[model samples]
Target: MASAALIESSLSGIPVKRGKVRDVYDFGDRLLFVATDRISAFDWILSPGIPDKGRVLTQISRFWFERFESVSNHLLSMNPADVPLPDDADLEALSGRCMVVRKTEVIPFECVVRGYLSGSGWKDYLATGAVCGIDLLEGLQQSDQLPEPLFTPATKAETGHDENVSFQTMSDAIGQELAEKLRDLSIQIYQQGSEYAQQRGIILADTKFEFGILDGEPILIDEVLTPDSSRFWPADRYQPGGAQLSLDKQFVRDWLETTTWDKNSPPPPLPEEIVSKTREKYFEAYKMLTGKECTW
Candidate 1:
């Protein structure tokens, strides 16, 4: 039998705020973030969780979070013993997929940075000649590298899809200074990650980040640089003007597209082949980037 999915986590001390992929339990001044194997696509959490998916996601986040200590992050520890788990909670189940995190007032927007023309960015560029209201050079292909990474911020919607917005629109929502800081930090992080992933033969096409305020200082909150939050393409096979094969969740998304189910409510369960292939992709990314198999 496959490993049991950690879809919901509840502890004694505090209330839990469940997101699309994480089960977050408040810890007074901190929080326990548990990466669940439950895969979400087009906003719906798919059934029959992919085994080892949560561990891969959590470990990947830990790798980047440690590598970039120069930036303030919410992570405290990935060790289960360090977390404030309830007496009844399953210790073995939570071991590798959980983190003890510093709690903060989370920033409202998704700090997205794109280094390539793809996905929604490509669609927007083809239609408006810009992304998030930032104009780009004309005649750019579908996967062409942008002049530079663009900080495309979007609203963090509770339900439905996230709406992309202009930098000016972000500034209008949350002061110009704060907006500028987020944009700069986002671009800087993406640049460094792109460089690093490229060295490992993976194209860090684009990624989104979440931030929050801790004692009046902006800090990185939530998972960073995981396959769920970023687009990772094999560098060797990367080509412009078309879709690139990815080492992320794109495999599953591509499979889903073939199904007759509408992109509305109640998505169909993934086939065994798709599940296994996607798990392999996630693990491949973790191994390729960290140079070690996910022993957990």
Candidate 2:
């Protein structure tokens, strides 16, 4: 495995916006998304990202986009060369980790779907017997599967954690019609993804989806079903009593919790063991889901 991580991408003279994990370059009608190997936990981008992490994310999104090609999305081409770039741009570094997509007027809320009781949902259930205004059944334990998936949207944040909001809150912010459409779409996709993962011995617990307006219609935007946006657990080791083994950055976050460094300050660099294990988990997910080796 390559130990070096591409934390950022350089496209001189091109207008670019860098997110925590992706570098998006602006074109008049299209955008170029480069998934750098940068990893973040607790709102902090940690040092020395897991190698080939970007490739795993990009490929996984590509796999799903192709599977659901009938669904409206922003993906145009996975090849970075399809987009215009500076003559001196490093296309080699961008290969297998970038997508050229149509630009749209982005919606401000994250369309989140939860099929399992975990994370903030667990916290909310423990406190209120509900998650985001939707009452859940009593006696549900952490990591327990819900009777059905819930569409819990959140206000998008540029720098920190996204604030979870109720479906009614989302309906109030956007029109009721649009909010309902997004909710239905999110749950449908989540069901398809969760079922597919189960067949592969993996559990797609929950995930976030982004949408944007294009030609007066909502189309899926940004990465889809990637580890960075979803919680994936091994099916064989599944347990509803507590947290299950995850294939995402939660492993890195677990290691950070054992450290003395405060999250408000700059996080400590990940040790070699953590980096290697995290990288392996990502690659393993790619292989299991797509049934192909991650050559990158």
- Which of the numbered candidates is closest to the native, going by highest TM-score? 2
Give lDDT tens digits, candidate 2, residues 42-127. Answer: 99899898888998999999999988776799999988888778899987889899999999999999999999999989999999
Tens digit of per-residue lDDT, candidate 1, span 262-296: 98869998888888888889989999999998775
TM-score for all predictions? Answer: 0.96, 0.98
Give candidate 2's error at residue 251 in angstroms.
1.0
Q: What is the C-alpha lDDT of each candidate?
A: 0.87, 0.91
Task: Name the best candidate (by lDDT).
Answer: 2
Candidate 1: pairs in clash:
none
Predicted structure 1: lDDT: 0.87
Note each model's CA RMSD in angstroms: 1.4, 1.0
Query: Cα lDDT of model 2 overall?
Result: 0.91
Cα deviation in Å at residue 201, candidate 2?
A: 0.8
Summed backbone clashes in each candidate are 0, 0
lDDT score at residue 258, model 1, on the 0-100 scale: 91
